[model samples]
Target: MATAAQKPLTGAKVFLMLVAFFGLVIGVNVTMMKLAIATLPGTEVDSAYSASLAYEKEIMAAREQAARKWQVEARIQRQGDGGAVVQLEARDANGRPMTGLTFKGTLERPIDKRADLPVELSEVGIGIYRGSASAVAPGQWDLVIEADARGQRMFQSRNRVILN
Candidate 1:
């Protein structure tokens, strides 16, 4: 008897083999993409940190420049009548009178609410603005001055004066 001829590989077998091979290749490609991305350097992260540092420096410089532009020198002089006169010496960046600037003063006694006094800008000198109010008692007083110059609130200072 003649032996049965071995069947040739079918088309379905060849197609399945091709599908499996392509599937494995696709999986390997996906894995390599993930690894490449994971190993990449984070240049954007470093740039963001550097940008924040630059912004902080810019803000600090702006604040410093504003402080330098609008400055106030204040003092309290003892009047001859046992009262203290609060003086605010206002100056611009070039040490000139910031004219047409409004000034407000609040004098509060350390112990008495009845002695709270408010004064406005009454005298404007060459480079000074003066506001005078009588002190009721001889003790510490809080002098709060607010100034507006060139549409900017440039000066706000609190000073303690001892009436002796």
Candidate 2:
């Protein structure tokens, strides 16, 4: 039988036991936190990169849809006189004519100092726009055409027109 003189657990031993239990709990908590962080997706550079990739895909899809919905074609030929004729054909995806579309054309000659011409398209027929004025002494002129249709902007292939 234990005697009354036998002291209870000393203060030093109780303090040491408490410290050990707290240290073990802290260690386990830290380990769990590390594992969670490793498995979860972080809001850092990787997240930003993924978002940008999605945005680029959306933009590309919109561009392709616009191209298929609207069609713009151009032709340049010599007139009976010394002037030139510039004709444009605009159509929808279904090959139907698109009418009442605004058109703008610019003829630029970088080599020549005074050869820049800008003209508005005239309505000729269904989905057809024509320019009456001839290019001024055209030599490697860049012909630009712009149009607005269905809330989308359509442009023609930059044609290098040669006036002979």
Candidate 3:
């Protein structure tokens, strides 16, 4: 029996194969780089030096805040339109309602800081604050609540919350 011979391998075929392989590799690398850059969250602090300098002050402030023994509670409820309703209650060490405080609430995304939403809370009842934020996507979030009195921060708390 006679058999036909296969075509000889040529330099052009080898070069083309190499080019196609490298092109695919480079294309995938470029796509991955773009995704990484787009999803990256910038530095937590603008300047490391400034943050370091304020570390001591932050510690002192935290100690003072803890010493106050303020009882603060925060609640978040998911809305129908991808928003959230925020409610907060505060009390002093003696269980009396903490009054005359300005409250600010923030819903921070765990992975993406850009998705953070700030809620402007207002006092409806004494020590009872309520606010809402629009365009809040559902998922895990860090609820940060801060209370201020006389232009000074008096209480602060951070809690993890899930919105379905």
Instruction: Quote the RMSD, in angstroms, for model 3.
Output: 1.6
lDDT against the true structure, per candidate, is 0.73, 0.73, 0.90
Models 1 onward score TM values of 0.51, 0.52, 0.91
Q: Which digits, one per residue and each the tens of the lDDT, describe model 3 over residues 17-101?
A: 9999999999999999999998898878899999999999889989999899988888888888888999888999999998779
Which ten-residue region of model 1 has the weakest summed lDDT?
A: 39-48
lDDT of 2 by residue, 85-122 (tens): 67899888889988887787877665543466775678
Model 3 stretches with alpha carbons more than 4 Å out: none
Q: Kindly list the per-residue Cα lDDT of model 1 for residues 49-162, writing each as its tens digit.
A: 789879886677558647678667877677777556666777788877666778888877655555777865555686677766765466788888877657765566678877
